[model samples]
Target: MTLRTIVVDDSIIFRKVMRDALSAIPGVEVVDIARDGSSAVDKIVAAKPDLVTLDIEMPGLNGLEVLEELDLRGIQTNVIVVSAHTSRGAEVTTQALSMGALDFILKPDNDNAGANLAQLKSELARLLKMVKAQPQLSMVSSSPAKSETLSAPIVARAPVRTTKTTSVPRPVECNLENLKTPKFPHLCHAIFIGISTGGPKALASVIPKLPATFTIPIVIVQHMPPLFTATMAKSLDNTSALNVVEATHGMPLAGGGVYIAPGGKQLGVKADARGNVIAVVTDDPPIKSCKPSVDYMMSSVPSSIARNSLAVIMTGMGDDGRDGVSYLRQNGCTVWAQSAESCTVYGMPRQIIENGLADFAFDLDDLPNLLSQLAYRAGGYCPVPPIPSTTAPMMATN
Candidate 1:
């Protein structure tokens, strides 16, 4: 299927360059080009392109203004921002994400514009794949005889728990005997969780059940954009017993609180001169096509949490957490993954479970109870039963 696209930039040369690059992509066709944001908005409405590449610094109407116009008109076209690498540009790009831009690409320096143009082609191809994957493009009609409905709402649900607590709760007694514990003994000082796809819902189910007295600091990397992440964090904070907020650079990961990696920035934990672990947000290149990537967070755990870390990989697309899980396992940290049956997308967890990287695999429904048990254990939590020799096969669910 061919994806119709529009390129919007004030620079005549840059607009042509983007048009030529996009036109070269296999399944993408440049349907229109606009010299500025005003023209872009008009052409977008008339052409109704499947995707839009917007320049951040356009005159008359900036990229953000164009997005606001689209929002006002209820146009849900996929948009990618082309921005400079200046601090102001980075801030603008981040703000654009908060305003619902899909993603942003750094503009190449003037001296290396040619080389950068080559790189932009590959990036545009990646963006095209992401655009095709969006739910909005599913409405596009290929045949002239077929009618398309572009007015439907994109069904996006905030992550929330589906179950209610019963008056009579069954309690499972703790049995320390006959349990095979690790020889070196894993201690979790910080808990790192990587989730995507149905993460908000999964987090809502698990986080609210955690005790306010739970001491270990928690850090989460949920695949999402800025506004979505902000909304999710607020939702979690309101529902869960613990305090939750979008993570900021240099902030200390405090006990009994949850820190969510803000969207559009790579979040990593690093130790300071005083040996205190602090959150670091950077405009570093994306890992596995995500800024607030799971791999980035998981890779930083060994150094931050040292041998006393716990890592969990939940439902998500791709193998972002596989290597990070492996690293944690090798460093004597406990790593857990969601069972396939409980996942919206079984990609990340499947990789770890199949590769023997995960120490325990549990269904989503069982996670809250298991975590409660661990939290109640003496000298921190531990999984009751050891991992089976073979992994349980996982399946995708809505």
Candidate 2:
């Protein structure tokens, strides 16, 4: 199965380089190349290739505008943004994700062209595999008009609950009775989310829909680079009723706030003397090739916290959160996965479901309400006992 592909870039050299790289990947055919955005859009709408490598900084009709135009015209195709490492590039790449690109690869800045192309080729291959595995590639426009932040009521969809019997758990009937009468008298102390590919758009759909009065402290590890995570956090904060900020060391993990783990650092939580959980940012090495890894963050969750936390594994390209989720579930944490139909890449969530670690799985539209309900109705607001200072001393973890 040859994946028809297009390379869209202003640089003649990069276009050729990308073409050669794509050719090296098995089953990828370079159907066409466009020198700029207008030509790229025209060629795309005409050829309708299976994949496109887009350069975000085209001279006219930049990559973002091209995505907007495609959304307006209802064109369906997988797009991988080839982006520079500049601040502007990071900002626009974040926007591109929210606008519905499947994923992105950073343009290597090193002068060694061979090394750069090798990295690009590896990243592109991974993203292509993710795109090919998706059951559906068509997507609705993520523009403001179609955004889920409006007052439209979300109709409940039945959640997918599974129990381990074999290697991969088979879905059983959703038992609302079981959900309501869990062993724990309440839902959770905190909500921890792990997402990667297609995360920005998904998070945009969820975080803003959460009511301002909802007070559960939500911590997120969205696999991204440094500047990219900060930019994404700012974007979410602008639209969200809940205060959203990039997690910093010593920051209090309090209610009514959403903390995004900083991109290049490991984020963990430790209880302060005042009983409030505070952020712990460390220069730890990457876990499973991901800095600020979901595993690292969730592993840092204390047993007291884990026993009462809800771990959400959403759309992503890899199984970074699986081990962490395993630990959490073992400690009595409840786990939820975003359903395949709602995920851009079902890799992460599928692992949870397959490993029998998921307590529930839901569509993107149904999650915000479910989270709010469990957080508010299930006695999630029990306040932490007050202590002295908001900050806590960082502790070393083995």
Candidate 3:
């Protein structure tokens, strides 16, 4: 099946380049192109393609305005916002995601376009394949994730026949109450997480559910560019009970706060002279083609804060968190993975689950309660239920 797509950008050069780049993909086809927001919307309504590459700074009406129009008119379209790497661009991209754009790509500035566009092409193709294979990620209404505890059974789609990456397959749904959680040497001192793709919406969904009395320090590695992470942290801070801030070098880890690893930099942990663990922000080379890599953050914890860690791997594009999770497991740290149905991409956690590295697996909406039970001790009623080895995995009816 051809991955039908449209490019909506005002720049003639970018329009041509993006069209050519997408056309070069084996299963993708550029269905149409629009130079302005109004025309983009009109053509989108007409073509109704599988995906749209929208520019945030288009003339007549901005990209966000076009999304507003689409929402008002009830036109169902999957949007991928192509935005600049500036602070303003990050702010708008956040708004776009909240407004229902599935994700955004960082368009390089004029000086680095030649080198960076190649990377952009690869990312665009990867996302297109992801969106095509998973219809759940391309929701036309509401945010990607909802801020609710696990109440409804997951509605699965026709099983996507993927090339089996491992011999031992994970059951579709394991009963968490019956599954044995990993034992730790001490109470979970901090929460370390890695997420991508649908994370902005996921964070918004999960953070509000965390109570103010919860005191576990949370550190997140969300794959993004320099200023984007800061903007995302600020957005989450406004609605959350805990204080959320962008991570800075030398900042000591503290309870009752959330720290986002600054984008375009690798964030690691280290012990200070007084033996207190602190954030180490650096411009180290990208791991698995990603700065702020999950592996980078997870690896840092094993030495400084391993035994008291509660590591989580969530939605993302690749196995970036695998090695780090392995490290956490080897060091006696507890780890949890988000269930596949609740994930936008299901790559990171899928790798850990398939490898039998995760201690517990929970749905995305159930994140807050899981955190409460483990970190806050607020859900003590369900704390560490007896594991039932004879139980069968529950299947999700499509």
Best by lDDT: 2
lDDT at 336, model 2: 86
RMSD of each: 13.7, 8.6, 10.8
Question: Using Cα atoms with residue i matched to residue i, what is each candidate's TM-score against the true structure?
Answer: 0.55, 0.85, 0.78
Where model 1 places Cα greater than 4 Å from the true spot, the runs are 110-113, 133-189, 193-252, 256-293, 296-317, 326-398
Pitting candidate 2 against candidate 3, the one with the higher TM-score is 2
Query: Measured by TM-score, how close is model 3 to the native structure?
Result: 0.78
State residue 21's C-alpha deviation in candidate 3, in Å: 2.1
User: Any runs in candidate 2 off by more than 4 Å, and if so which?
Assistant: 138-187, 385-398
Better of 1 and 2 by TM-score: 2
Task: Summarize candidate 2's per-residue lDDT along 309-376 as a digit string, tens digits.
Answer: 78999998677777778877877898888877788877788777766777787889988888888776
Q: For residues 276-390, what per-residue lDDT tens digits would candidate 1 score against the true structure? A: 5678777766666676877667666523354667788997666676655666666677777887667755667766666666667778888777665655552553222222334
Alpha carbon deviation, residue 372, candidate 2 (Å): 1.8
lDDT of each: 0.68, 0.79, 0.74
- Each candidate's clash count: 3, 1, 0
User: What ordering of candidates by TM-score runs from best to worst?
Assistant: 2, 3, 1
True lDDT of residue 238, candidate 2: 95
lDDT of 2 at 347: 75
